[model samples]
Target: MATQTLALTRLAASAWGCSVRRAKELYTKVIRSVLAYGASAWHKVADTKKGPALSLTTVQNSCLRTVTGAYKATPQCYLETEAAVPPLDLYLSARAASFEIPTETTGKLQLLRGACIKAAEIINRERSARRRRQRRPQGATSETPVTLWPSDAQLASAKQWLGGQTVEKALKEKWEQRWFHAVTPTRGRRELAAESPPDCGACHRYDDMLKHEASVLMQACTGRIGLRSFLFTCRVPDVPTPLCNCGEGRETAEHLILYCKDFKESREHLATQLAPNSLRTRRDLAALTTKKDTARLIVKWLLRTGRLPLYKRAMEVGGPPEHVNLFRP
Candidate 1:
């Protein structure tokens, strides 16, 4: 379990240490599949019991802590909310409910939804329980979770435990974070895995650099690099002041790469490539999604400014960044 969740250290190691948001996304993409295969069977079983000797909650909490880049003592609620992790029972019921009406965009998910519903109905219901005279979706399908459990009852237990917050609302939130940002239709499930998938923001891009100078530079464009404050959060030893050597203020990643005075000369040539908003503020920085050209500009500024070496060294110590050094950045 530790190995699976802690594995993010590799991804975090780039001069761009992973941010809390990015860590959460990676946790879902990587660790989630590892921890929850065939999860439905036990997802609801022991999730609600307080501190069971070995509960799914423990595993989830552990993973949540790792992804949020939070410490052992951080509040579980904060971690869960930051990571957009639904409460345990809520997650399971959502899984069960998804089968009740599958999200249609992803072919694979649709199949899984169909299987879970059909399998559960086949296994739980008596052969005679299938009344051909009753209404069914596909001519003569088995009773669905909605039919077996009332629409209101399905969420009753969840609401009771969650201080009246409906599973519908929680699942709706999960749909955006855990699933893609989908707009649920008034009458039916909205599309996910968009026909034109929104490109990843740099903060969420993940690519392990293997070799080649351009690729390394491109990998640097991945929003994996962190700054002084982030490294300090990771408890990196020998950290200098968060303030930049340039003396402007705290050395944030955006300032270091895009807006610092010390890098002004270096950034001069590259400045031509920047989107007007790219060099503006932190939100602009976070919004700098997947334009390979923008990464080139950032890396160019880093190299020209001579901060690249110090930045990479700090990152290596903190997360042990994993770019293949084909060319000298």
Candidate 2:
């Protein structure tokens, strides 16, 4: 049943379909609810056992991948952070723990009551410890705090016991750690905001932007687009090398946007559009993509380059009517 709902959501969550925000909403309201049906009754068992939890997690990972348009190799922690979705175990346990039963109820309700009480106790303990740490004086503890579950701990149970916000914080920390140490060329160059949710601010700011444009921007930012460099890393059979057609360097997002001679004209147009804010280096390009107006221009510039075949329609059709003079500074 969860698989069927996931199949339907794949279309709306696809690269050219809808914004990441909307895609995540669809997953949470539709597919996740379906997967967690009767969770209060079975969550306890699922938490301790791997079989059911693993199956549900597989479905969720697929949904998140589609929603984010991320590569298959992207870690599950990264996908969860990017989608702003809590881990499945944590989600299910929270749902179960929040279930309320009548005080006068008896019989079969006893098992559910016990499970909820146990989950609540675990959550309270963790929450209290977190508060204590936060209350500590600055620099009081030089030791690095542990944000992840212990290696020997049961996966689902440990996560299920944590509060939603706690789980999310830990996941974000884990993502930052992995991102910092990532060996992949493109991923290593990418940066994540410390305090912000992983959703693109640019996409949210430009409410009227086309879905395809948002999708392209996201792919470019994450380094998972159809660039030859990324394709080569994925071992795509047809991509002979990571080199751009111009032969100067690999066809990475950074290379194409900042240095590739092939897009020199488009880059010049981008500079003209973003007057007073030139793209002289990779840091300049990164700064440009963070702002709402400049990010839109970046999208336009990318579309004009005609390099991203997946977004060809956006280039031909152009942006919304109001954005016709988007290039005018």
lDDT by candidate, in order shown: 0.46, 0.62
TM-score of 1: 0.44
| Candidate 2: 10-residue stretch with minimal lDDT | 146-155
Cα lDDT tens digits, model 2, 214-300, are 656556666677889889989999898999999999887778778899878877877888999988887787777667688788877
Local error of candidate 2 at 8, Å?
Answer: 3.2
Clashing pairs in 1: 13-321, 15-225, 16-224, 16-225, 16-226, 17-224, 17-225, 17-226
Candidate 1 Cα errors over 4 Å, as ranges: 1-31, 45-91, 99-226, 231-237, 275-278, 290-292, 303-329
Q: What does the lDDT come to for candidate 2?
A: 0.62
